[model samples]
Target: MRNENQGTPRRTNRFWVKVAGVGLIAGLIGGGIAIGIGGAIQHHEAVVSTRVPSGSNRAGGTKVNKNKADLNGEATRAYNSVQGAVVSVINKQNVQQDNGILGMFGPTQGDNSSSSSSNGKLETASEGSGVIYKKSGNAAYIVTNNHVVKGSSALQVIMSNGRKVDAQLVGTDAATDLAVLKINSANVTTVAGFGNSNSITAGQDVLAIGSPMGSEYANTVTKGIVSAKNRTLKAGTDGTLTSVIQTDAAINSGNSGGPLINMAGQVIGINSMKLSSDNQGSSIEGMGFAIPSNEVTRVINQIVKHGRVIRPRLGILYTDLANISAKQRQSVLKLPKNVNQGSVIMDVKPGSAAQKAGLKKYDVITKMAGQQIHGLAQLRDILYAHKIGQRISITYYQGGHVHQTTVKLVP
Candidate 1:
């Protein structure tokens, strides 16, 4: 019985060994098939896909192109804000026409055909720029240079949207070179905002918007920086000193009365004029001036309220004492040796404040209103500060003797 049991165990062990060998062969085949399939899939992917560096651009990528957003910067913001408020001012005058009647030698005066249509007046046109600063009820106020509307038989304002409307001259102040006009506010889209010129400093960014050469270039924008905070520029050969804000922005002939825009999208200045050439006939560039918004607000308000700027007038035609030769000073007017800079009274109008105060021709005004007067500009600066009918003291030199008198200012 023991011998039979031992033989049965040997038989069982032999059967299990054969089963293990068959299982090992089948497992190896299955593993090889799985590895081959993975390699084929990976090879297919490598062949079909395109590879690129990490930072490289793709055909359809998610990056922003800043150049395409050129109109999204501060300059664009400022221009966009005020461009709509700017308009072209046209000055139409009835000039005499030149018909050359009876040939060129007929009459010295040209025939009035060109200027005169049927009623014998031909229309001549001049242009500048202006800003719509205020809108009240059915009327909108536009501010421009006084010289622009000077001698205009008719005035027209061309809006940004190409609408032309008649403009009535509200008031004009030649001393400040500012004029106010009114137009129907029917299609007014935007009214420009004002900024405190006192808050802006030199070297700040600025933009000029205007009809540079006419309505053809209306709303043309030029960029620059504030070259100076305050510049005293003479206007109209009168040597009338006007305090202005100097900028490097390009201001052309037709740019006068347009707005000088700041980065905050506010009008800080009014483009007044630019230096065209020096006395030596040298071309000048990058020198442009504007009326400061603070002064503009002050002057325009008075112009709007009154038909003119009611300045306290002493009514004396004077020249700067510095312009007089030292010989003339010591010989004609006989001013004191110590007195050099002041306004020399040339002609005081009859019944004027100066004349009423006993001032006469050749009287050198040394001081006014307790302030030292160096020249006509300084005297005007001080004189305009007082109201009409106010009593002010004046000091003068007559025949090398100093005298004092009180004068009542008048408009």
Candidate 2:
């Protein structure tokens, strides 16, 4: 029960499997084995609300009829508006066949050979959810979590009506855990709209639409309130800081890349990961997070235009100073007695920003752009905050002496 990212691992015989590791955050990607349902596209109109008139009470106060009141009001409308646009994403990978002597001998009598061994076939590696965001020129674009389609040989999209279509990988940004996909727009009748995530306040109603536990539960909708805004979490293996919207919605395995919609039926966030437990192995609940739609729009635009995200690079590998022993800091790095935290440059890329700035190996970086750099992660977080070609100040200790220099960031 250590801190781990959660993605549903592949299971056989309709069983559910969980992936575990040392991280509290769990990506809602389902890797379970499932059967795809085939059918034609079926369109569903948004539900209309019915109004009931209020009656006068004996005390002269207006009394509304409880029995005739619309219980499925905003939530129902919000869900219906985007339900058709939500889809199930399938990640298929090429199953490797055993090349050993036993595998080459083939299955003997009474032996059950794997279906993937019969031919060079692909198998379902994982499943998640996605939202159809845009349609243009016979192609529809989808947005989902990068982990949902990571290491995939091929990807498929299961529409709301159970229609399956091949999806092309447009681009993926692992730092943000977001990916863009392209599919045929012929059967895509609905396109979810983006809302102003920056303006969404805490306690505002929201809806989450996606497949939970695979295509078998596709188009599932859950209601919740915006628990908090601007919640930051350390994402990816590199510990990149990512800001996301926190909610109490029921985002489960297979809901990754799905849309978190507002009461107005506009997508405010893209469901990504959740905190499943504490570092001490205590189970926690109601702590799901989604990528703010504003960031998603920015990243996807660049991905669609460039097939990749272009970010400023420091062109140097470094280790966190906190990870080094005090003896190593003084003996190997030759740092001052008070200097305990920084990034120790390991290698500088040739003809790159660090090299151009006269930075060398063993330089301990203490500050960047006037901000204190405690470790590599903090340095990276500050570095990524600037744009490419921007000049920034860098402070480091060289030969036990402190010095400051300006370096222009490059892409």
Candidate 3:
């Protein structure tokens, strides 16, 4: 011991250590260490590693700007995730075909004559983006849009490292504009997780990854912001309002069914449609929408179980009841129990849940599940809360007497 308890030497050593720690932190704040930190943190990639991947930077190198780091991270996550989920998709699309009946007119619809190099046997192939939700028995069930792989059932997935595999159709739901697919392949790479759409705030950064007019470029990335939320747009193909996650991300024709990812690489929505002048009135730009992931999970669960998402209809027309003759009553004006309140049962669908439950014309619903019936929106919200097969208790005013009934839901 060289003065083991000496205060002078101990103080000097402690001062140097603090200085070093501060220096390291400062370097990470705005120096090249940030890229390294990002790589490490993502890898936890937060701890330590002997090997650094191609896209990752080294530790204590530099710091990236807040915005830049966020953008870079989002793009990287999307590209990696997209590539991983794309497995074997390219293999299905890029095969050379023969000169057909119209010779130079190209292969006719539903032609699969180019998958083999040795013999003239027909093997099927098609190009589309597939999202991995879960690993089913001997296969992975991926989801995509119907139109992408509609005609031919043959599905292909391309992996991050360029490996390919053939996929199958799981199920489809046309009403909700969603489809589920499955594929069997070894070494399958990624499964995109669902992000909470309800937690999304406006102005948050977002990224869209898709092929878009070029199926070969399967993992192309575009940047944007959460322009709005809970936006109700239309998908003309299905007469229902597409409850969507509106963003400034550029979504083109072929981008449908791709994911809208956040900086953390979590998918918040499914890229569904882009608002074009043809879809709207005037020139619409920077407006794109995605199906909320919450809705996606629900529809997927239904399709996987029942081959369709069963939505029970509560038979009644809102217009049947008269509201207080105020224009705003439909929106802002509150409803009273005996006045502009619940929908009057006008005409019930034959053998519908309402009809079976003894609901009749002019019957006024006063409350639902003990919640006051403000109007149709409130009623719709309450009803939507119940799944098909769930029983509901509703109170209504009819025959000058208050009565309640339990109704079983059906899709």
* Best-performing candidate as measured by lDDT: 1
- Report the alpha-carbon TM-score of model 2 versus the true structure: 0.66
What does the lDDT read for residue 318 in candidate 3? 49
lDDT of each residue in 372-405, candidate 3, tens digit only: 8765545655676678788888998666567899
Per-candidate TM-scores read 0.71, 0.66, 0.63
List ranges where model 3 is wrong by over 4 Å. Answer: 1-83, 86-127, 278-281, 316-346, 361-384, 395-405
Q: In angstroms, what RMSD does candidate 3 have relative to the true structure?
A: 21.4
Stretches off by above 4 angstroms in model 2 are: 1-67, 97-118, 196-203, 230-234, 237-241, 317-351, 358-382, 385-387, 392-405
Residue lDDT tens for model 1, 124-184 = 4789999999999999999999988988888999999999899999988888888999999
What CA RMSD would candidate 2 show? 29.8
Ranked by TM-score, top first:
1, 2, 3
Q: Give the candidate order by descending lDDT.
A: 1, 2, 3
> Which candidate's TM-score is highest?
1
Candidate 2 lDDT over residue span 388-410, tens digit each = 88999999999899998899988
Going through the candidates in order, what is the number of backbone clashes in each? 7, 5, 26
